[model samples]
Every structure is written in C-alpha cells, then in structure tokens.
Target: MNNNPFCLPVFTDKWIKHFNTSGQEKRFDFIENVSFVKKSFLPVYINVGKNLTKGISYKFSNTGKDFKKKVFLLYDVPDYFELDTTHNFSSLKTIDIQQYPGYLVGTSQYPDITAFKKSRFGKSSLAKVNKYKRKLESSFDITYTLYYGDISRETYDLVFDKFKELLEKRFSEIHVHNNNLDPDEWEFYYDVIYDMILQKKASIYVIYDGDKPIAGSINYHFDKVAIGAIMAYDIDYSKFYLGFTIIHKLLEWAIDNGLEIFDFSKGKFGYKTQWSDQEYYFSYHILYDSSSLLANLLSSIMSLYFRLKVNLRERNIGMLKNKLLFFFKKKKKRATKDYKISEFDDTIDSQKFSKVSFDVKTLEYLKRITYDFLYSRSEHIRDIEIFQDLNDKKTFVILGKSAKQKVTFE
Candidate 1:
C-alpha cells in the first residue's frame, strides 16, 4: 500500500461505488491492491466502465496458481500507469483499446497560465480565447471563484443546481444526453461531492454573472494530479465561447495552486486536443492463465469485441447514431422553428418596431443572439435595448449601442 505510486481518486472506494457500481458490487475490490471478478452473465462484458474507469497502477502477483476467475481484465489503464502482470499470468494480452484519446497539461511545468498558453497554443488561438474572456467580462459582472477544501452548503447547492440546468440546456440544443444529470445517479453526486470538497479531493470553479453561475467545472484531485471531471456552461452564453474561457480559467487555477497535471481524461473533443501537451492512451490489460482454456476463449472474445467497437467509433458511427437521434428527437419534440435570427439594418418600417423593457429571463431564446452581438460589436449589456414589432407578434428587434439584430418566428 505504501509503495503504490498511483493516487487516482477514481480508484478510491467511494468513487467506485458511486460511478462504476451496478449490480456487480461483489465483483469489484481495490486499494492496498485491486481486483474485479468478471460479470457472471457475460465473460465478454469488456466495457465494465469504459468511459468512467480511469484505471489503476498496480501489477498482479502470482498467488501460487489459485486463480478463481479464469481471466482478469482491466480497462482504461493509462500507459503512464506502471503495470507488470507477467508475474501473474503467462498468457497476458495487452490491447490498445483506447476508444478516445486521453490528454493532460503539465501545469507544474509552466510557471503561469499565460506562459502555458503561449507554449501550447498558437497566437491566434490564444487571442480568440482572450477575446471571448474580454467580451464576457465586458457584458456582465464577471466573477471567477474557486471552491476547494471549503464552501458553504447553500452556495454549493445553488452552483450544482445551475450546473445541471446549464448541462441540460446545452445538451438539449445539440440533442444529446448527459449521464451526469441522470436522476438515479445525480443524488450520489450532490451528496458525495460536498464532503469530498471539504476533504480536498474535489473542486468547483465557477464563472459567475453576479450571483448566478454562467459557467462551471468540477475537478477531482489526488496528490499532484487534478482530473477535469465535469464541466458545463449556460447555452445562452455560447456565443462568448465559454468553453474556452472556462478551461483557461481552470488551467490558471490549477497552475497557481501547484497541481502538476490537469488530466483532461477520456475525450477526443477539439478543445481537449488543442489544450493538451502530453498525450497518453487508455488500454485494456487482459491476463489469462494459459492452462485454463475457458480463460483464453473468454479473453480472446472480449478483446475482439473491444477492437470491433473501437474500429466502429473510428469510422464515426457514434456521430451517425447522434444524427439519427437528433432527427427523431426533433420530429418528436417539434419540427417547427421556435425562432429565426438574421442581420438587418436599422430602418423605419410600416410594422414599426419599438423598444421594450425586458430582462434576461423575458426571452431566453434571444440571449444567444444578444451575446453574439456583444461578441462582434463593442457594446455592454446595459446599453442594449430589446424591441417588439407593432404589427407582428412573432417579430422582434434587439438594438445595441452601435449594432442591431432582427429576430423573427413563424
């Protein structure tokens, strides 16, 4: 236990119970050492926790050939993690079953965020992110707060609630389901995270517009590594490119606080790839006793299944499935357009659009257009005015200090 170099919080008993547990609680074991009995129903249940499992760093040892399970499979085992299963099994099969790339930023390597950004990203990319940050701050009372090791229960609840709301709204627009918001598991998150935060194992970085959380990220920390766990931004703020800004802020926090690695775990998203300096793969470690025919058969079958799945993902079948869902969901929800936005020149028309008193809550759909206008034009939120068309209920206009946008619906 003292010799274990890996301090991944994912392998902790609490994380395993909350994130990876199904009906197979009895099958999984860990800590001083780790082990998992394969699923009873299927020996080929290879993806036990494909996306969620960040793997462990321990080698299996020979226990005088008294293996209860024919085959042992470990997934998401990062290349950096030390593992030598040769002592345990003669027929060990290591497969590069990484479905998506894993990334990390060596925060300790750079003195500060600016230097880190300068070294990792080109000037244009850095400038673009900076522009978004500037625009966001210009439009609102922006506050960047980091809550680690201490936070009031009330503020924690409020931030998490808003985080879930933003996640739902963002994924809804793109027609996808976020597993984090699943009702069955969300309670675990709400309950577990607070104590974890107090224990210094968890963190929440929030970008606030006054008291409201517009963007946020929850990260897990162990030793020097900080895992970028969950992140969400209000879709209404999408035009400001809050994703880039949130990451930049998070990186800044991580570096300032002495986190060595910012593990952008298990994703090939454009942002992750762009920000990453060190690249590693999550692989499957299959150990089977050569004497056991059942073990060999099962491990081979499981390995083949993972290879096939990875191949399918490579061809972008996942995107195809999402597209299909988007089509079906759009039809099921509503084929009609909620609103349409276009550029227009301010002019006197017979319909006669007039400025109206409104708040952000009045027309949620208009928020994106308004933010986009702020991105392109030099105007603050206070200087902007919303207008309604006298003749058409479906038509409206948003007038900024120097720029205007036309909003219409059918």
Candidate 2:
C-alpha cells in the first residue's frame, strides 16, 4: 500500500468507487487505479492520487520491466517531484519536467482577519462591501452559516440541490451550461460530498435571505489545508455581490478554525487573488524506462516533442492568433467601408429606447469595432435585433439614444 498523503487506501478506495461506474453514463471513464495498470509496458496515469484538485500530476507508471517498449509518457506531473526522493520504482527510465505555474493561497500570509481584509480588499473595499451588505439587508433578513462535522441528512440534500442549481444558472449565463454536467456526474459528486460530510471532513457555508438559502460553498478539510471544492450563488442576488461575500466569509471562517492554508484549489481568476497572499506551482513530466537503447531514444524524442509543445502553448500562441486575425479583420473592415452605408431608420424609436435593430451583416461588422467605438455607448442600447432586408442591401441603425451617445459611427 502506498503511504503517500493522497494514497490513503480507505479514502482512495471510496473516491474511486464514487467516481468509477461501469455503466452507459460514464462521466469519469478515464479514471483508473494506478495499481491496476502497473503491469502494463507503459502505464499512463495522472499524478492525481485522490487529494489534490488544482495542479494535475499526470505521469506514466514505468513499473513494468519490459524494455522492448521502453518509452512511456506521463503528461501532467507536478514540478516539486524529486526523483531521488521518490522511491519504490525500479523501471523508471528518464524524465523531462516542464514548469506549469499553479497558484494557491498560503496560510502564514495573514495573522488575522483584519490584516487579511486590508490586504485582500484594499482600504475602501470594506466600505463598498458594507454598502452591498446594507443594500441586501434592506430587502431581506440576511444570515451566514458555515456547517461542519456530521451534518443532518436533510440539510445535505438541500445544499446539494441548491448548489447544483446555482452552478447551472451561473454557467448558463456565460453560455457554458452544457459543461455543468449530466445527472450521472452529479450523482458521482453527490456520493463524494456525502462521503466527505459523513467523515466530518467537509465544511458547507450558506447565506440565507430570511429562511431561503441564496448562496453557499462546499469546502473540504484535508490535514491543515481547507480546499474550496465548489461555490455557487443565486443569480437574483448577483447585483448584491453575494459570491464575493460568501468567499470573504469563508476566509474569516478559515482563520477562526485554526486552518493553516486556504487552498483556492486552481485557476488564476481575479477573484482568487482577492485574498491570496502566495501561490504554489506544479509541473508536467514525461518519463521513460531506461532498459534499452531504443527506449532511451524514444524517451528523448517524446521529451523534445512535449517540451516544444508546452513552450509554444505557454508563449501565448492564442494571443498571437488573435493579433494576426485582428490585422486581417482591419484590412477587411477598411475594404468594406467603400460599401455604401445605407441608414434604414435613424429616427430614435421612443418605444424602442432599450433596443437596437440592425441587419445580420451589419451586426457582424459592428462586433469588430464594438469594443473600441461602441462600448461606452452600449448602455444606451438594451436588446439587439437582427433582421433580413428584403432589398438585399445592408443597413446600419442605432435604435436607441442616450446622453452618453456623443458620436455617430454611421
């Protein structure tokens, strides 16, 4: 049995069982126990043992002695791995490490909530937060609660349902609702949440407007670190900034609980930096067994390929693509300016002050310069309507009027 912090047999077994299901609805189909694949010539497994969430340690388990198939690939391993320190492996051939920066909040950064609040939100942020709090309180009675220990069965189900609903709602607004996942995936998550709660290793924080729960977060406690698992809030209360409020409340809870670290878990979103003092990084590695010359050669080739790919990816290739694409877009826009700009209706429709009507072709063109030329005037327009002109001629129209609309693009 592996004695690694993440390799606890009891909890790991439960984790696997919760995620692994041999059914038609295979959400976590790629997850397999490392022990099961140790005998294969080149066993590929993620460095994820069951504990860490953010930096995925992906690697190939080269425990098999078959030298004919020497080169193995482990895609995403952490940078902190020291080969000399890691033991119990006999056939690990060669390793190539690629640095992937991951961020985490350090526990020792702040002594207390006051210091954390000052550093995280800045000086005036507390006043703004209070303003939002007061606004929320004016409408409804507001209360915050963090649940730990063995929670009631009823509360667990309610929290689970509300959290899932809020997540779906939030993602739907961002047009990523499909990624919110299916029922089977939710069931798997339900099992893990239940297990964590039953073990008294989970902390659930809820914000209630009167008796109705509006926002909540589910966090897991492992060792001295508190890992934020999932957080969601009612979209209706988005104007009040409930999400930020809940997370701020969680940090206070973390300080009070004597937790050493509040692991924001992964992703470098701006909100994560609101209270984060430091970040931890991880690496990706591709390893090979060094039994044969051919194996060594193959490993070297893969190492080069992976290194090049990671470098290219990390060099902001997407930004380059956008720039090149924008250059061509400017050329196209300049060319299209020669086309006659027919104004269909320049009259400000009093009934349609919150709407903009334009042809599909005009809308597509507007999107290019909308950020630079029209962003400031966007608030004057509420809804956009694209219509097909029967005359086969393109027309651009600004259907609304605002005091902010000082320039006319057409």
Best by TM-score: 1
User: What is the TM-score of each predicted model, taking all chains together?
Assistant: 0.82, 0.60
Candidate achieving the largest lDDT = 1
Sum up the clashes in candidate 2. 11
lDDT for every model?
A: 0.71, 0.53
Per residue, candidate 2 scores C-alpha lDDT tens digits across 1-410 of 12222333434455455543421111112222232213234433233222233323222343533423444444334443333325345655456565445445555567777677776675688777656656655545679887776778788888888888777666544433332245655775676666666665667889986666789887766666676767788765555678778877887777776777777765456777665776655544444556656667766776677678668768876446644654553422222233333335344453433333322544444432322222323321233333333333343343233422212233
lDDT of 1 by residue, 321-409 (tens): 76576566552231224678788786746458766654645555566667777777868888887888898867888787778888898
Worst-scoring 10-residue span by lDDT in model 1: 1-10
